[model samples]
Target: MSDVTTPKRGRPGYDQAAILEIAVLAFNEYGYDATSMGVLASRLTLSKAAIYHHFSSKEELLQLALDHALGGLEGLLLEPGAATGAAIDRLAHVLRGAVHVLADRLPYVTLLLRVRGNTDVERQALTRRRAFDRAVATLVTAARDEGSLRADIDPAVVTRLLFGMVNSIAEWYRPTGPTDAAHLANDVLAVALNGLRTPA
Candidate 1:
């Protein structure tokens, strides 16, 4: 009788989650337009068939990554700390939470920040990003109304500037290499809000 071997019980050493993680890195390092399923397969040591089995297309990966990053931030806005504090206090807490998300979800948010709306997937993401920024800007407006934020500048202008600094963290930030996001946030806000002031 000829010896025969049957296939393993299940797909081993690779799954949807693992594929997503690799995809996130790949997307971040090489912009989405340049990354291909074949390249991903080569990196993962899996066949094109295996990758197709997990995600239908690159767009799915983009959407899923955005969901992972934005989901955390969206949830942070609704927390009791955000809902029940002085406007400036709540805004600061929400901003701190945002810095954490930006650091921890660096890859996803990086992709999010670079999107230019060239494709349906990108346009959808851009829409969501605008909505999120608008909501956060509303909070800044509230803080200004409460006399906590500087009255010299427009709340909308300050909102964009503040978030521009926060969002730029993804570009050059190395979470393990040095300065954590919280300390960075404090320092940036200090220079921004205090403007070279020493303790009185």
Candidate 2:
């Protein structure tokens, strides 16, 4: 029903980036399984053939979104600023960074958070999410080992609880809310790390 024909590699004057943006919105609005190539084509004012030329399938589009959302998050941990701090301090810095990352990648990550593990693509995304959490758990372990954290519960438990508190931010956090991401992260860290029950 569209006049657009497929260009070589589907250059429709819209590159991979534009498709990614539009596709993320579609996935968010319709869920990955419910969205089809035709739906994307309809929205883009391009042919289904054109959408396919740029992306192998709907799954591929989801993968690209995941990479963009999660990649930015993994980068903060490796930054030199995250390197020199004590474990708790580094943990705070990383949390702060995560809030910014979440804000930056809000829609992509929002769709990421909503996935129900109904498909292989969703399952793989879940695995990657767990992997990122484990990395932060390692920081909790380091803090416990260095005696900076109170010893009682396992480091893994603390990390789980910490993320439980952090992950919910997506559900309620708004870019134009009364508060900003950085302050929210500090508050989250304080409650998760400081509000814990200690032997003291």
Off by over 4 Å in 1: 1-12, 192-196
User: Could you estimate the TM-score for every candidate?
Assistant: 0.87, 0.82
lDDT of 2 by residue, 13-116 (tens): 77777787788889888877788888988999989888888889888888878877677777778887677778888887777888787876777778878877
Q: What total of clashing residue pairs does each candidate reach?
A: 0, 0
Pairs that clash in candidate 1: none
lDDT of each: 0.78, 0.79
Model 2, runs deviating above 4 Å? 1-13, 116-118, 196-200
Residue clash pairs of candidate 2: none
Model 1 worst lDDT run, 10 consecutive residues: 1-10
Q: Per-residue lDDT for 1-200 in model 1, tens only?
A: 11111223346677676687778889888878889999999998999899999789988878887777777677777889888888887787778888888887777778788889988878887887788788788888888889988778787888899888888788789879679878877876675555658978
